[model samples]
Target: MSLKSVSAKIFAKIVVLRIQKWANNPIETQQKVFKQLISEAKNTVFGKDHDFENISSFENFAKQVPVRDYEELKPYVDRMVSGEKDILWPGKPLYFAKTSGTTSGAKFIPLTKESMPYHIEAARNAILCYINETGNAAFVDGKMIFLQGSPEMQEKNGIKTGRLSGIVAHYVPAYLQKNRLPSLETNCIEDWETKVDAIVEETKNQDMTVISGIPSWVQMYFEKLQKSTGHKVGDLFKNFNLFIYGGVNFEPYRAKFENLIGRKVDSIELFPASEGFFAFQDSQKEKGMLLLLNSGIFYEFIEATTFFDENPKRLTIGEVKTEVNYVMLISTNAGLWAYNLGDTVQFISTKPYRVIVSGRIKHFISAFGEHVIGKEVEEAMHKAISAFNFSITEFTVAPQITTSEGELPYHEWLVEFDNTPENLQKVAEYLDSEMQRQNSYYLDLIVGKVLQPLKIISLKKNSFQEFMKSQGKLGGQNKVPRLSNDRKIADALVKI
Candidate 1:
């Protein structure tokens, strides 16, 4: 083995050792992490405001600090942007990670010198854990491509600001830089189509061993490479053996991706956001990602079903149970205190604390009280696709509430198809049935004649892509919202 591979194996072993200890007693590890985070920030403005010093326990912390969403925390974030020191954290943040803002306008989340390493370390440990589990360290010796956002950043109030992926691109370890692909120049190109084309030209012949990106963008890159070289991705990069993906569920696109690659490869799912790297798929045998309990983030959960209640039950890592959907709340070294990150998750394992990303709290349809979330919608779509023997490029659902006097309200789906099925009506019927199976509220509405069966609107090729491009969210950590309560995105797709 080469010296580089030898060193990588050593490092992976070290990380795996540490993770083993952390995983053995997750509740204790999380408690210690929460205490450390509270202690570190107790002197800051937010900390003092929330009486953090007297917060000796989780109950105290929960009682003292009210849960806040992005909008609620905007004033402090705005102050940080305007060059305030010790306003949130002990000092000004090193940078801000800009979000695509599907629910709200653009948000600039803090990335501090103290907190940034957590992101890097968590990602590294994810790879290390995979290596430890599978004995696959050879990929480290070959070229790896991380199809991420541009590294080029804009300055705001003396702080560097860009997409989290772009900021992370600037921090690729010096040693691994040699094996990374898509030259920095190509990465800096802001336009998605232009950058993807450049990437295809640059890495088409390289000995790529690992690839990482959001599933949709990676699929696009694979398609472009196939078109240019007239070869499957596996044929072009024979060493490609691992795919690291985040920002969306991979199951819906798994079959299509297998076809594109001409074979199946090992895969890892990550739960990284602008806020922090929270969880990762640690074991090949496990269905969900193992929560990073000892990371520089303290986590809390509120039952998602009653999230909007006047007084929701806030549970710590020690209190959360298995198989219940919960809205995630986090206190991070990045200076966010008891912040609701808006995503919902369900724990599948309580011992090591493994979770699956359920959906976004805001990305739901609740018109007429028939609530439906992204998970249910995706599940329904998955069944429909399988039953129809077809594949989808992308899809979104919205509630069509306004109708004529005689018409009932219904759900509308805008789907971009990779393989259009012969019978769309039957596909729509199956989708409706699957949704009813997943959500009893939806089923009751259908049975009561309060709502009509879901409608499927076939989207032209690249319809969703055009819409994302128009919204300045074409690539890199941006995703089309899966379910919307309103017709804003649905209307745009129809117009397209």
Candidate 2:
């Protein structure tokens, strides 16, 4: 049926408010909305055993809730692995969007029916914002492809059901719902290559109007697209209109995509979790992304610096400050309250609360007093790769400084690319320049002897996914966790 009118109205109605909400709202308005959400969240889960006595008792109550890893929620998480039905949601959940954990074993985060409306709304808001700003709905007018894992959902009775890829197909825009291209499934849970052959078989020669999914998988998708056809990357997607991507940093793979499509991709970011979709790029051309303000759940941010504190404190929607980086904290209907999602981001401006992802708190590098985080690495890479425009297919950095008589550890990078000349030295030189530009402390430390120069090593073809697969962490939602901060990934990257 025609959600065109509904879609048009939804997208149009929020244009001004979304812009205002993302950029610079009145402080009082922000606080009022924040407080209302807090009250709504409390009221939403009041009888569900999430006890928050009052706002004053929140600090201590926050401490009382255990800091949980995915494994801690294994039982509930299993239900979400892949399937249509689970206790995680109120109604039957439409799909099981698979994401990996520390290892692949089971980071199966369930998307609950109780919470999918928010995801749909956020996605709508992003599309609407883009249309209002750039009039780019032509991106949606074409055949959209979501490069996700299998349609598998874990069941309470211990069997996975529905393809994760299948579930998303069911829930996306109805106009495109019937036109979803066939997905590469069956082995989505096994590892990466299982879907490689399938990715190629399906994507080849297809007119992909809009493509969205994890960055790594997207890279792999087109790489195989190039290999299978014996042509360059652009040959596979010449008809591509727009590319929407998320779940990992798009910097590394962007160049490759440009080469393959032979065009400047119109990209948008989506911030959805296994639990639910949160926010996305509202306008096609804006510094800040629009916040899905009234989506199913309420969102809040904790100061990034304070997130790792022993007694980490959380700022309410009204109380949280902006512009600085903050770890994402969500109050979702999916059995999580004040949940620390581990990812971090920065506020571009808050009138409309547009934010740019900084990086993950746990995925940080602390070699030799250089607390290098994902955002630092991403910004450095974004600037350094400006000339080459070479999409970084896969990359990881190991922190080690040359210890000459107690020398500190430095960063050693391993990158995979599809290019003619593989000049490691040139890549390293530019990386050093970027490091100096992005982080003054890092530059000062390099001069003062805490770290050494950066190193870039290119990997053989198809090595990245092989490395991820071997570790049982390869799939749609999972990526090659760029800043490993350890030797495990280095060993894995080199071996692959």
Candidate 3:
């Protein structure tokens, strides 16, 4: 916050712009850059010192590296936490970012001081872009919010054990640090009740320049705030800065936030995980998020869906199908290689390489976005529909559309239930509100009443068995996936 520090950051911002300008075409830029990083990763994995003067040397080393997953990095975590300095990046590491995916259990990825500089750079670049794009940086004069994980990290043998958020928080700019809002979930001490009781009073009047965290928590918190005080957030704060978040999309909960303040706000993206901050929106355009490849990690793009009779193929940055979905693979400075990130993405543009989140590749419904992931749909619908002394024990959602026809105009939501009203017309209105309250795109794409209403599936006992039998994943890790690609489940849910 000092003049010297501020001036230095301004200089760094200019350098980033110059570098970004040179990478005009993201496809070519990624291909050339990735090949270099890939080469360095290979050498690093095999025990080699990096010649930091020129990054190209690391690129050369990546060629000899072998692909690895999280399980393969256990030895490094143990050694690094033990204070050994020869692991992934040189020097003592601060903390590991905590993340959990489909294949890997909750993994705390190690972060060294050398790599931390880049992590800060990549994330800060995005923040700068948000400021430049919206011209809304003036709000920073107020307070900003980050709905981060807990501020606690476990320590072992004088070294901290656990994810990087706590460690990263320690390193954040001290002035900015003063404005961070604590998490309602993780910041708890059973024996210390006074601290828990104090957060509400402390946070009640903080100059929150930025509000960031999980969308679900963000939505739930604001609702709680309103219900508790009977006064909206706008009445409390005259100028709320920005909402920076990760882990999930904010489109679903946009309505609630915008409605609360009576003004629309732009939300920024943060893709950091236990792995690392891979990419962030470029702070140049309306949604100019860019991939930070040269930082501590390199990336690989894999085919998301192969034809029924075709083989799976790995695509490079150039080969990524525009507008098609892909499974992301990571090779990070923390010693993780070729690890598949369960989320899916769609490339919207190649110049400056842009992407739109399609949905979870592992989480799908008949290949449609409607394939609701997690138990939210059942929970939301149950709360909305079961007011008349009725409740839902089990339910499922599937997309049923005439794929065989020309550009099927609409998709239908098939819902199964027992002991419900015969008239299912209200299904569309109620579920739509819940879905829209959750994702903004769902509201945008499925607007108007063209799509089929929520077709209630009144099920008989043991009927869900037939449903489970149809998916082949029943009783397994896959479990009858809550969302499906076809509407067969909804079609049958209406029958009983």
Candidate 4:
């Protein structure tokens, strides 16, 4: 083994020991984090506004601060963007992770100096944990490629601002810099399609042993490699054994990926976002990710079923139960207080707090982790049909993940038109264009060829009503969901 691989194995064991220390005392570790957050930010603007100085317990903190989404938290973020300091966190943030928002056009999520290291460490620890468990650190000696956005960041009021992935690209460890693939110039290419092509050219002949990216995007890269060299990804990089992914559930894309790579490889699932890096797959034998309780985040949970109810009970880690879906609330070191993360997760193991991301709190479809919400689709439909004289009665969308060989998956929109449009294909194009404009993730998937433009399926008149009637609710408050990640509703609509 190379000296680097030997060093990595030694380091991995040390990190795993630290992780086990906190994992064994999860609740106590969380309580410490909560107290520190309150104590440190008590003098800041948000803390002062929420009366954080007088708060002595979780109950008091909950009473003082209400759970807020991006729309509700925009006032403070806006000030931060305009160069205001100490508005949210102490002094100023190190960076702003700009992401597509539902109500707000773009969301600027703060990344503080105090909290930023955790993001890098959590990802590193995930790999280290695997290495420590499996005694496989040889990948450290070979090339690693992280398919990500442009590392070039723009300055917004003297603070660096860019995509979360782009921001992370700047922080890659110095030790691994030599082994990382796709030259800096290639990584800075703005167009994703061109970037992927450049990446394939740059890494195809290298000793690549670890590949990291969202599964859909990685599949695109794998397809390109296979087309160019007439070899599976595994054959192209003989030592490649680890696949690191995030954003969406891998099961949907697992078969496609295995087919492309020509074999199964070990994989790690991460729970990360602009808000924080909350969890990572810590074991090869586990079903869920290990939640980072000791990180600079305080957690709360409200049962997702009762989230719409008035004054829903916010439970702490000690109170959460296994197998129950709860909308996650977080008060992080980045200065978000009782922020609604919008993700629903089920605790598979409350003992050490391992969670599986269930779905978003809103009715939506995220088969590729595009997070296309109901409002965006409705607005897109309105824009798409603005030039036409016809209107659709009702519509619902579902992801069509299962496809024939060599065909990409797509969103299947079932629509009951008031009167059938003259050219249905033209309408589909307009609707797809509007969706791409509204959701950046959806746009990326389209441009990357990971998904085809959404396909519109026409439904006969009263199809929705007839389906609802069959379900014993013809009318009166019972409504069809606008979008689903699964195809149950779409199948029923097709059958009707």
Candidate 5:
């Protein structure tokens, strides 16, 4: 082995040791982490405003700092963006991670010097943990390609602003840079299509061992690579063995990805968002991601069913129960306090606190009292797809509220198919049935004749991509909302 490979293995082993120490007692680790975060931010404006000094317990902290969404926290973020120092953190943030917004045009999430290590370390530890668990460290010797957005960041009010991946790329350690693929110059290409082409040309003959990115974009790149070489990804990169994916659930695309790779490769799921690097799949034996308890972020959970209540019950790590879906609230080193990340998760294990990302609070359809969430839709789609032998490229669900007089409303699905099933109607029926099985409210609406059966709209190839492009959200961290209460996205898809 080369000297760099030997050093990489040693670093991975050290990270594994650290992960074991943290995993020894998750509860105690979280407690210590929370206290440290509070102490670090005690002198900041938000900290003094909330009297963080006197808060000794999680209860006191929760009571003193009311849970806040992006809207409630916008003023502080705005002040920071306007170049205010010590507004939310101890000092000005190094950069801002830009994310898609609902009401606002875009959200500028802060990334501080202190918090940067947590993001980088968590990702590094995830890979190390995988190596430790699977005894597969040889991949570290080869190139790892991160299929992400352009590394070119724009400056906003003297703060660098860009996609989280781009920001993270700026901090990749020098050692790993030697084994990273798709040269920095190619990574800075503004257009995703042009960038993918450049990446294919640069890495076609390289020793690529791991590929990481959102599944859809990675699939697109894989397809392009195959088209260019006239060979499957596995044939092109014989050493390729690991796929690290996040930003979306992989179940729907699992079959498609395996086909592209020409084999089933080991994969890892990550829960990194613009807000924080929250959780990662730490074990091959475990079904869910092990929550990063000691990361520089304090986590709180509120029952998803009561998330909109005037006073929702905030539960600490000690109070959280297994199998219950809760909206995640976070207070991080990067100046966010009791901020709602909008994600809902269910704890599959409580001893070490492994969680599955259930869905988003905003990504749900509740027309006529029949509330349906992203999880239900995704599960239903997976079942239907499997039964019908269909492969989907992309899909989104929206409630069709408008109808003629005496006509019942229904859910509309705009789907882009990679391989269409024999009968589209059967596929739609199976999906509706699976959804009804999962959600009792949806079933009741159908049984009571309150709503008609769901309708499927087969979108032309690249329809969703066209829609995303039209909205100026074609690449990077941008994702199509899977479930929307309104028909805005659906109508746009139809027009496309």
Candidate 6:
């Protein structure tokens, strides 16, 4: 083995040991982070306004700080954006992660010096943990590619600002620089399709071992490679063995990926965002991600079922239970206080606090009180495809509340198939049955005659890509919502 490969294996062991210390003491580690965040920012503008000086415990902190989303927190953020110091954190942030927002044009999530390292380190540790568990560090010697936004950044009031992926691009460690690809010039291409084409040309003959990106976008890259070389991805890049992905469930896309690659490969799922790097898959045998407790972020959970209640109960890490959906809230070292991240998660294991991102709080279909979530829809789709031995390229679900004639409103599944089923109606009925089985409220609605069985609409090739392009979000961390409450997405798909 090369010297670097040997060193990586040794270093991976050390990192895993350090992580185990906190992973085994989840609550205590979180408490220390909570105290440290409060102590460090006690003199900042937000800390003083929220009375952080007298706050002694989780209860005290919770009582003093109310949960705020991006819109609610904009007043304080505006001051920071205007070049004010200590408005939220102890000093000016090193960077602002620019992300698209629904109401606002864009959101600038501050990344302070203290909190930024955790984001970079968490990503590194995920791979190290895998190496420690499986004794495979050989990929470290081969080429790696993370399909991301351009590293080109803009300066806003003296702070560097860009998309989170682009901002992260600047922080790739020196050790990986030699192995990382598409060349800096190609990565800076503004158009995603053009960028992927450049990437294909740049790395077509290299010994690529690690390919990472959002699954949907990476699928597009793989398709382009196959079209160019007329070979499966595995044949073109024989060493490509690890696939790292985030931002969506991988199960729904697994069959399609295996088909494209011509073989099965190990994969890692990450739960990262502009707000914070929360969790990552730590075990190949496990179902969920290891929640980071000592990462300079204090977490609170409000049960998703009771999230809209007047004054719902807020629970700390110690109080969270497995299998219950909760809206994740965080008070971070980056100056966000009791911030609502909007993503809902369910704990798969609480022994060391591992969770799976279930869905976004606002991204659900509750038009008829059925309250179906992203996880339900994704799981239902996966089950249906598996049962019928079919494969799909992409899909999204939305409710059609206004139907013609006397029929009840129903969910419309817009699916792009790689392998069509022999019986479309039978597959749709199976999908509907699976959905009803997963959600009791949905079952109740179906039984009570309030809604009809879901209808599947077959979409042409590249429909989702066209839709994304129409919205000016074709690639670079963009993804189609798995489920929406209304027909906005469904209508667009039909029109396309």
Q: Which candidate is the best by TM-score?
A: 6
Give the alpha carbon lDDT tens digit for every residue of 1-496 in model 1.
7777777778888888888798898878888988898888888888898888998999899889999998899888888999988877899999999875545688999999988998998888888888877878889988999989888899998999998998998888998999998898998998999999999999998999999999999999999999999999999999999999998998788878988999999999999998999999998998999899887888999999899999999998888898788999998989998899999999999877899999999899999798798888888887776777788889999998888899999999889989889988989999999999989999999999999999899999999889999988898888888999989999999999
**Which runs of model 4 end up more than 4 angstroms from their true locations?**
364-496
Q: For candidate 6, what is the lDDT?
A: 0.93
Per-residue lDDT of candidate 6, residues 1-496 (tens digit): 8998899899999999999999999888999999999999999999999999999999898889998999999999989999999999999999999989899779999999998999999999999999999988999999999999888999989999988888888889998999999889998999999999999999888999999999999999999999999999999989899999999999988998999999999999999998899999999999999999989999999999999998999999999999999999999999999999999999999987899999999999999999899989999988987899888889999999889999999999999998889999999999999999999999999999999999999999889999999999999999999888888898998899
lDDT: worst 10-residue window of model 4:
471-480
Q: Write the per-residue lDDT of candidate 5 for residues 1-496, one digit (tens) a residue.
A: 6665566677778887887787778778889988998898898899999998999999899889988888889999999999998988998999999887879768999999988898998888888888777767888789999988777888978899998899899888887899898898998988877888899999889889999998888888898999999999999899999999888888889878888889989999999987899999998898999899888888899998899889988988889999787999999989889999999999989867899988899889897888788888988988887788778889999888788899999999989988878788888889989989989999999999999999899999989778888988776777888889888899989988
**Stronger candidate by TM-score (1 vs 5):** 1
Which residue runs of candidate 6 sit more than 4 Å off their true CA positions? none
Model 3 lDDT tens row, 414-444? 4433345555556556765677666544555
- Position 494, candidate 4: lDDT: 98
* Clashes found in each candidate (C-alpha, N, C closer than 3 A): 0, 36, 43, 0, 0, 0
Each model's C-alpha lDDT? 0.90, 0.63, 0.54, 0.85, 0.88, 0.93
lDDT of 4 by residue, 1-496 (tens): 9898899899998999899899999888999999999999998889899998999999999899988999999999999999999988899999999876758988899999999999999999999999999999999989999887777888999999988888898899999999998899998887665778888899999999999887656866887899888999989999999999876666535655777788889999999998999999999998899999988999999997678889999999999999787899999999899999988888989767899876668768888978776656766776665655465656789999999999999999998775677998898898899899978899999999999998999999778767876765332213466778899889999998
Q: Any idea what lDDT model 3 has?
A: 0.54
Q: Give the better candidate number (5 or 6) by TM-score.
A: 6
Q: What are the C-alpha RMSDs, in order, of all predicted structures?
A: 1.6, 4.7, 9.9, 13.6, 1.7, 0.8
Using TM-score, rank the candidates from best to worst: 6, 1, 5, 2, 4, 3
Q: Write the per-residue lDDT of candidate 2 for residues 287-326, one digit (tens) a residue.
A: 7555555544545567776766776666655565566778
| Candidate 1, backbone clash total | 0
Query: Between prediction 1 and prediction 3, which has the larger TM-score?
Result: 1
Positional deviation of 387 in candidate 2, in angstroms? 3.6
Ranked by lDDT, top first = 6, 1, 5, 4, 2, 3
